[model samples]
Target: MTFTAMVAQPPPMPDDPGGRGEDFGKSSPVGLLVLLVFLVAVVFLARSMTKHLRRVPASFDPPAGKHEAPEKEVAPVEKPEEQKNGAS
Candidate 1:
């Protein structure tokens, strides 16, 4: 009356017409068609991406060692002189 003895017994065979279940060992035509369609779509997408990428420039940065205007130095402001008490 243990669990092992109960599961150890084999299941009764089914009286199917073909004497076997559906065989999945071989590829079907529909599966091959789906794979072919996926490959074609990927090729088209890659070609489109390449065409768009070619229009972009290699770099958008400004040229090195070039200045539009010369730089100027700023002078420090002078302070007012302190007046003595009531002095002219």
Candidate 2:
């Protein structure tokens, strides 16, 4: 006996009452211009701050009577050659 298989089909899309024309009129051009102005002001302020920081000089010495020497680090003790040869 031979059997025939049925092909599957996608469901039809729903109709939109308010289409693409209804969405186009809702955009605000003035709000977009204000956002652009604010972005430009922020970029200008950031560039000014970077220039000010670059012009400043670094202090070489600490405040008087507060100067202290940094601590010296102790290295780990290495094994002698005589001990290595004896183990082998």
Candidate 3:
């Protein structure tokens, strides 16, 4: 047998109960409205959660006795003067 012989024809398309694609949008207005409402709620919820999360800090304190020593200021180093023409 060949591939052509094994292939079957597709079923016929069903008749439209309500005039072609004319009622397509009419039937799903509620679904679209619900989806929009859900999307807006999700965005607002995420924003609120993010705002609250930012208020919390990651680390509470440094490890036991691992406290960093106080920083000290150091005087700036001075550069030697450049020699003039042929000076040893």
Q: Tens-digit lDDT track for model 1 on 1-88? A: 6555445665765787363555636779999999999999999999999999999999977668765556899897554443443354
Best candidate (score: lDDT): 2
**C-alpha TM-scores of all predictions:** 0.45, 0.37, 0.40
Model 1 worst lDDT window (10 residues): 79-88
lDDT of 2 by residue, 17-80 (tens): 4564446557699889999999999999999999999988787677788788778999977679
Give the Å shift of residue 2 in candidate 1.
44
Candidates 2 and 3, the one with greater TM-score: 3
Q: Write the per-residue lDDT of candidate 3 for residues 2-83, one digit (tens) a residue.
A: 5555667866657864654545546577888999999999999999999999998887887788789678999975545534
Q: Judge candidate 1 at residue 84 and give its lDDT.
A: 41
lDDT of 2 at 57: 75
List ranges where model 3 is wrong by over 4 Å: 1-27, 61-88
TM-score of 3: 0.40
Ranking by TM-score: 1, 3, 2
Off by over 4 Å in 1: 1-22, 64-88
